[model samples]
Each structure stands twice: as structure tokens, then as C-alpha cells.
Target: MNLFNDAQSRSDSFTLDTAIISTRVYLVLLCISTGILISYTALTPHMSTIIIKNPPKKTYENLLKEYQSTLECPCSKIAILYGSFVSLSPVYHQVCSSPFISDEWIISSQGKSFTTKDSKAIQSFFIILKVYCSLTEKTVSDAWNIFSQSVLITSHTISNDELTIRTTDSLNQFESKTATEFKRISSLIQSYVATMFSILESNVQFAPYQSVNNNSSVNFKLMPTTQGNNCSCALNNECLQIITYPGVTIYDIGVIYTVPT
Candidate 1:
């Protein structure tokens, strides 16, 4: 019985020792695994990050050359109008605003023999001039709006001087085109007006002009003189001479009309 008890105690002791050894081994493996996990977590972020030392600076010219047409810089104000940058104010013929074109002047200028047809024709002439001026301004404004819509700024970082330098040729071309268009329209208007009044020949006698000392015959004068003082219509179509009629103090910068000779 004593031998059996001793053998049982030895067996239990051996089992406890084996269990302790297994527990120690498991704890050591767990410690090793936790250390590895912590190391991996600490290194992951740094592994993905990249650092550059003393990078070279890039210039606009160099970048433009490298990227060619594929490069683009965003603008803060993308939908700006041309009027914001440019102002187009047209100066109309002085006659349009002068007292000579007024209703009072027209009525006072008429003689006793002045027919209704003659009065109507004169009024219509002034009206045409005023309309043309208004239409020309509107047409140019619309053209500028369309041109502004088409313009694209490739670089937002560029200075105003640099942008102006780059776009000078394009702006000049647009101005030339606009001027050409204005000239064409002006020519058309002049031709139309001339044709409409062709029936009234230069030699034809109108109503007896009482405005100038009760003159019996009214002479329609056609003076082909241009603006003086280095005025070239080719360079500027608006360059016109101011004409003053006899016995009138106010100067009339006439577009189509001329002073009586």
C-alpha cells in the first residue's frame, strides 16, 4: 500500500511539472508574438512615408517647356467678363448731340415753301445717324462678350505683366478685327444713306431758304474735304473734322453732312 501511494504521488508531481513547463512555453511564445506585433505596428507608417532632401525649385518657363499643352493652372475667378478688364466707350458724331439736329432747329429752319416730305427726310437722316451709333456700340459689346468667353488663361500664377506680354498679339488681332468690322458696317450705312437721298441732286433747288437773308435758291453743297492735322481715316475712322455752318456759333462734328459752301 505504501509503495502504491508513493508511486501515485510521484505521478502527480510529474504531471504538475509537465503542466508548468507547457504554461511557461505558451507564455514565452505569447510574449514573442506581442513584441513582433508592436514592432510591425510602429514601423508600418514610416515604411509608407517618403522624404525629399533639398528638392530643386522649378520655374514657369521650365515647367511650360516640359509639360507643353497638357499643363493647366486653375484661376480664382473663372467666369469674368471682358468688360471687367476692358472698357469700350464709343464717341459718336457731335451732330447727334448738337442743337442742329433738334426738332426746334428743324422747324425754325423750314421756309414757307418747305414741304412735309423735305422735313421728314431731314428728320430721318438724323434718326439714322443716332440709330447707327447706338447699334455700333451694342454690336461691339456683344462681340467683346463672345471674345471673352473664348479666352482661357493657362496659368493663374503668372503676373499681370507676363500675362499681358503673352496675350498682346491676340488682343491686337481682336482690335484689328473689330475695327475692320466697324468700317465695313459704317461703309454700308453710308452707301445706304447716299442711295436713299440720291433723288435730291446737288443742283436741285429746295424750298427758298429764308434762313440766310431770304435767299431765293438753296444750293446743296458737296465738299470732299477730309479732316486736317494729320488725320488719317485708315488709322482711325472716327477722326472727323468739326464743321460750323454760317451764322451758327455751335460747332458740328458731322459724319456725313457737310457745311454749305
Candidate 2:
């Protein structure tokens, strides 16, 4: 009687398990069927109440008009707006072309001569700029990365938002080496570029006229020339005195010079 009772209990447990499994299966099928019915109802166009939430036609038209007006607004004002929306306006022309407005400045051979005895810092910067101008836009970017690292060998200069040259970590020799090396390679690469572009068109520009004389003429000479005395009256010896460059490099002097026309 004990063995028979044990077997009967096992049979009851098995029956309960099977019932649970069947109920789960049935529930799953019911959900699937309900989803199918919903899908079918959704596709039926005549039963519009289910799918077409009747957004009022007038409201829709007004919204469409609003969108059209937004698109029609001047692209100049809306596009590329990070404090220079009007700078690139097609209606007006730029003082200098877009290519000339790069972070780098192109100092030509003629312009460079003006700073022959100039600061090493300014001269080095111009060398980098001249290098940039020689290459394609893509190439210029590649060169800038390299030159940026090297320019800091002297010291990183900060002229506000205008320019800020940086070097890698000074604490680690590895970083310093990398920064210096990057600049050296970048300079070599861009030197070829600057030379190539020099043959095409002279994009280099001199510094703005530092001295305008009484007659409205610019004086580019470091010293007062005999020519200025006879020409329209402008500038004196004070404006053309010998500038002192002590701790500064050759390039810094040049940066401060007025480019000759």
C-alpha cells in the first residue's frame, strides 16, 4: 500500500506540470492571435477611425507654412553661425579671401626680407605659414599639426584667440622629444609645399602699414629712406629707428615689422 501511494503521488505531480505547460502555450498563442487581428485592422483603410487620428487640416497647413518659411530664411544668417554669420555673407565681400583667413599667415619672400633682422619667433611662425600656403588645403592641415608641435621648442606664444602655439609635456622627455620631432618633420614637409606654391602664386602678405605719413602714404622701411623725403610728406626718423631685439628670436622682430609693398 505504501509503494502504490508513492506512485500515485508522482502521477499527480506529473499531471499538474503538464497542465501548467499547456496553459502557458495557450496564453502565448492567444497573444499572437490578438496581435495579428490588430495588424489586420490597422491595414484596412475604410476603418479610418483606428489609424487616421484626424489632425485638423487647417492646423496641418499652418504647420507646413511654418516649415516652408523656416527653410526660406536667409541661409547666410542661419548657417555656420559661431560669431561669424555675416563675415561669410555672399551679399558682401570679405576684406581678405576665405583661404587667407587661415590660422596661419603666408609671408612671401618679398615680405620676409622686410623682417630679415626680425624676431626668431615671428620669423619661425612665418616660415610655418609659408609652408602651409604651398600645399593643398588637406596638406596644409597635416603640416599645421606638425609645425604646431615644433614651434613650441622655443616657447608657446599666446596672442589671445588669434594664435596659441603649444608643446607636449615638459615633465617627460618622451613627450618633449615627440613634440620637437613632430615639428621638425612638419617643417620639412611644409617647406616643399611653400616652395611649390611660391611658383604658382605669391600668397604671402606683409604686415599692415605701421606708418602713414602726412601725405597718406605708408612707410614700410625700417629706416627713413631718402625717397620718402622727396615723395608726399609722411613719417620721420622716430618712426624708422633701429629696433632692439635682445632675448627675442629673429622671427619675433619680423612679426612686428611692416611688410614692404
Best by lDDT: 1
State the lDDT of candidate 1 residue by residue for 188-217, as single tens digits.
886666545444322123443344545754
| lDDT by residue for model 2 (1-261), tens | 122334455579776566667767878898999999999999976622222234355644554465443322112222221222111112212313333324444443324433434433344434544444443343434534443443222222122222221222322443355456666766676555445433332233344456567757765533322322243112321122233334456676444432221
Report lDDT (Cα) of residue 88, candidate 1.
53
TM-score of 1: 0.42
State model 1's lDDT. Answer: 0.56
Q: Please report, in order, the local distance difference test score of every candidate based on alpha carbons.
A: 0.56, 0.41
Models 1 onward score TM values of 0.42, 0.17
- Model 1, residue pairs in steric clash: none
Task: Kindly report which residue stretches of model 2 are placed more than 4 angstroms away from their true locations once superposed.
Answer: 1-100, 103-170, 201-261
